[model samples]
Target: MTIDFTQQALQVLQIEATAISQLARFVNDDFNKACQLIMDSPGRVIVSGMGKSGHIANKIAATFASTGTPAFFVHPGEASHGDLGMITKDDVVIAISNSGETGEVLTIIPVLKRIGAHLIGMSGNPASTLARLSDVHVCVQVEQEACPLGLAPTASTTATLAMGDAMAVALLNARGFSADDFALSHPGGSLGRRLLLRLEDVMHTGNTIPMVPTTATIKTALLEMSAKGLGMTTVVDKHGVLQGIFTDGDLRRILDQRYDIHDTLITAVMVRNCITAQPQMLAAEALKLMEQRKINGLVIVDQHQHPVGAMNMHDLLKAGVL
Candidate 1:
């Protein structure tokens, strides 16, 4: 017998996609009740299952933990040993079993009941043992498994995982979880840097700021821009108050006018309405402002409008804010 690999793969994908689509009906009142139980609990959420369900349970726990819900996974076999000690009555436990009668998962049901932990069960069978024992049962009943023999997990696990995500997202919305909150749970990489980094953290400070006095020549401003390498220079008054900004772009535009850079005041050609940002503004927000203004650099200012710091697109790239 010859096998068609692409057709087989397509069939599996179609079944799983259908499994996900059928999940909306399961997101009914019982789902909200389960979310309420988790929200009202004083302790964390515990997720547990056997085999393939265990893999999905682990990811679900991670999603909950990353999204401001305190959660972790415990293998049902491990829970039977001594890991059950990790769970408390205040915690809510979400148990998974496709058949709803897995021996290892079932073995811990009475213990969970005795401990008074709120139980949310996920099972493909509504009439199964785990579902019957749960405080709230979420049915992940799929029409069929994607497996050719209907023995492997396939579509059932996909539906169960989808339901878990729906639960986590609903709870995330209910709790008003924000990007800042997510950054706290994940502070290791570009994701954290993007969310947590502020303009103050990356801007060049004090002497590095490109500046030329209002009385200075455009030639002086160009020299300062070269020394600072920001492609721009701030034209300020003797009082150290910002007056305007001159950029290499300004130089290009005024080239045909034949004005002598050697003698012309920078304030005469500088952008008087240049945009500025606060030192405390988010680097991400600064990036947006730069794009919107179609400018390359920004002067960070204090409340008194004195330049406190400066940054450009290259600085953002080096800081990984890009």
Candidate 2:
């Protein structure tokens, strides 16, 4: 007898999808009340559960913490021994259990209550003891498990995770969390680098800036570009004000015209009114601008329009902003 694994896989997907769809109806006043309690709590959200629900609870806690909800997970079994001290009166406890009668979880309810912590219960059975004890009950009820024998927690766990995500996102929106705010908590990730890295952080500054005077000959500009190795040089006036930019492309065009590099003023051959960036501009934003303009380098200028820094595509790539 050959097992049709593909058909079984599709059946499980459909069942889990249906379970998530059914969760829409459960996002009612009780869900809103739960969000309000978590928002109003002075301390962090304490999440606890047992068995497969415990695994889901750990992920829910991580999601909440990353999305600005300030939450952490505690094992129900550990809480009975010594971890219950992690909960405080100012905190909100979110307890998860499919049966709602898990002995380890139920054992600590009285202690949590005695400490004056608010309880939010998530269970598949709404009429279970955990639901009655909770200040707000979120029912993650699903019709059936995606498991073939209806024994393993499949669709039920998916529904619970989706519900947790919904709650975390609702709180995130309510708090007016911005991308920059999210990036703060994820400083070591790529998203954080894109949002937090500034042009000044990666641009070639000080003596490394490729620059030539507006009155300098094209030959002098070429020397500056070569010395800095940025393939371009900014042409500035006597007061250090930006006059224009001359690049290898401009040199190639000038060479095509057979202009004398020794005699031609850089100002006459450079690109006037060139695209520039400020020091505070984001590197990601600068990369977009460069791609849009089909340019390889940018001159960083200050309020006085004086060139302060310079960077090329290689710099952005090295800085991980490419």
Question: Which candidate's lDDT is highest?
Answer: 2
For residue 279, give model 1's deviation from the true position in Å: 1.4
In terms of lDDT, model 1 sits at 0.92
Worst 10 residues of 1 by lDDT: 235-244
Q: What are the per-residue Cα lDDT tens digits for candidate 1 across 16-54?
A: 999999988888988989999999999999999999999
Q: 129-217, model 2: which lDDT tens digit per residue?
A: 99999999999999999998999999999999999999999999999988888889988978889888999999999999998898899
TM-score against native, each model? 0.97, 0.95
Any runs in candidate 1 off by more than 4 Å, and if so which? 1-4
Model 1, clash count? 0
- List residue ranges in candidate 2 displaced over 4 A: 1-4
